[model samples]
Target chain A: MKFPFLKEAITSLTKKPSTELYPLVKKEAPEGYRGRIKFHADKCINCGMCIRVCAPDAITRTIEKTEEGDKITFQFYLGQCTFCQMCADFCAKKAIELTKDYSMVGTDEEDFMVRGTFIKKLPPKPPVPPAGAAPAAAKAPAAAPAATEKPAEKAEDKKEEK
Target chain B: MFKKLIEKGIEKSPWLLHINTGSCNGCDIELVSVITPRYDAERMGFKLAGTPRHADIVVVSGPITSQSKERLVRTLAQVPDPKVVVSIGSCPRSCNVFHGSYSVEGPLDRYCDVDVSIAGCPPKPEAIIDGLAKAVEILKTKRRGK
Candidate 1:
């Protein structure tokens, strides 16, 4: 008589239950796990790379022109996100990061939104010329062209004479 | 009296009914794993019910395709009041990548109020457990209100 099953059955009784005590004892998501979108507005250049790479169109941007600059706001709706990490990968500035916080549970729609805002300052305008200098500045280029044209006319006349 | 005791009992064990509209099976697989031995959602008093009438929670996965939209609506209607609707993944919440497709009729809120949304392509088993635990809390309150 083979008692092969008896030894295995007895050892099973000593083995601990595989069930995880999740709620009571929190678990951490593994490293590089793409869970939630974290937008770094300060680092973002607003190049629209993340928006382009997003397959779901979960990323939306609104630009409001203010006295300071163009105020750009980016909204990442987690509800529509695929968590593909494409936005993070395409981001040139590393402004978008996929965090390991996988427990993204919420009741309100707004709760799932990740937003960031940044103001892009306008480039400095070139210094305007004074009234007196303006005429001289314009005349300088006009006179230089006339000076070159006179020499060319003289060369043409010499060629005709030859 | 006995009513309060029965209410408490009902709150302790909330049976779930899973409805797949037109999922890619990613979320469905993750949902099943939550009930497996390793994740064991039963330890928290969550059980999968065969029918909507028996369910205290409705777990909806997938983007609602035109083919499934009617059935989804009918099934949701069958669920009793005080039932919590839990969107299992990005699909049900806003249709994810399937948004604006010709067949998809969802982003589940257009049909009913979503009680809880667990956002992911297919949320981790631990995350599913977390969402389910939150649903149980909401269930307790809804029961007390009634």
Candidate 2:
């Protein structure tokens, strides 16, 4: 009962290594651990909430007009991020998420950037007769019946077409 | 063969010199934790050196404040050639939340080229170890250049 060394030795023998075998035997990050950022472009409404809440101003949004609509790109610069989780929390659509993967070692500046692109389609413009097309004398009489019957439906059909 | 063996040995054991340039001490704690038994970065032949002259890798933490800029430059100059500068945490890389502060001069890139930048407010212990491992590889190349 007085042999303290004997008891310590037995406990040490039975117990596994205190060290985490990282790089070989990987370990998982605990719950709510804020590490790398994940941006879901689809879910993002481009509200700019994440950018506003970010203390370090690590979040950036760039918009480009495309045939579809607006191509929005969000670049989360991890190098400038504080990992305070404010960006994820303030995101109204929950577009921003903090993943558990903490290994962010990089040889280049671009490696730490988390980028996502989403194209928001613009609503089709309503068709309007051009004033320049003043063939009214000849065209008016021919189109009078059809235009009067269902002009609204024809505009709706044009809106849906690719 | 002897030269190759020596290089291999040097590659295996890398002594790091930690420099604190007005850090919030968050990154510093995580860095110290890497050497503890739980993370045990020493098993990978990594160690914290007492002086910059003795270190193979320089681990810098915090944004370089205007006051500490000169000291940082002087300390870095003391480190011998073929040394790898590994910037740890977001503070050193981009000053994190401290960016644009009156006292904070800028990030580590202003002084010297950073070989490895581990980005986090205060990166996890494992991330620091991984960054150091990568620094060792970079050190190998620098050694060859020398």
- Which window of ten consecutive residues has the lowest lDDT sum in model 1 chain A? A17-26
User: C-alpha displacement of A31 in model 1, angstroms?
Assistant: 1.6
Specify the CAPRI tier of model 2.
medium
Q: What TM value does chain B of candidate 1 have? A: 0.97
Q: In model 2 chain B, where is the ten-residue run with the lowest total lDDT?
A: B120-129
Candidate 1 Cα lDDT to native: 0.93
Instruction: List, residue by residue over B1-146, the lDDT tens digit for candidate 2.
Output: 99899878888998989999999899999988899898998899998899888998999999999888999999999998888999988988888888999999878998998999898878988898889888988998888887
Give the alpha carbon lDDT tens digit for every residue of B1-146 in model 1. 99878887888889999999999999999999998888898877889999999999999999999999999999999999999999999999998998899999998999999999999988999889889989999988888777
Model 2 lDDT tens row, A57-123 = 8989899998889999999999999999998888888888999999999999899999999988888
In candidate 2, which residue pairs get closer than 3 Å at backbone N, Cα or C atoms, i.e. clash? none
Report model 2's chain A TM-score. 0.70
Error of 1 at B56 (Å): 0.7
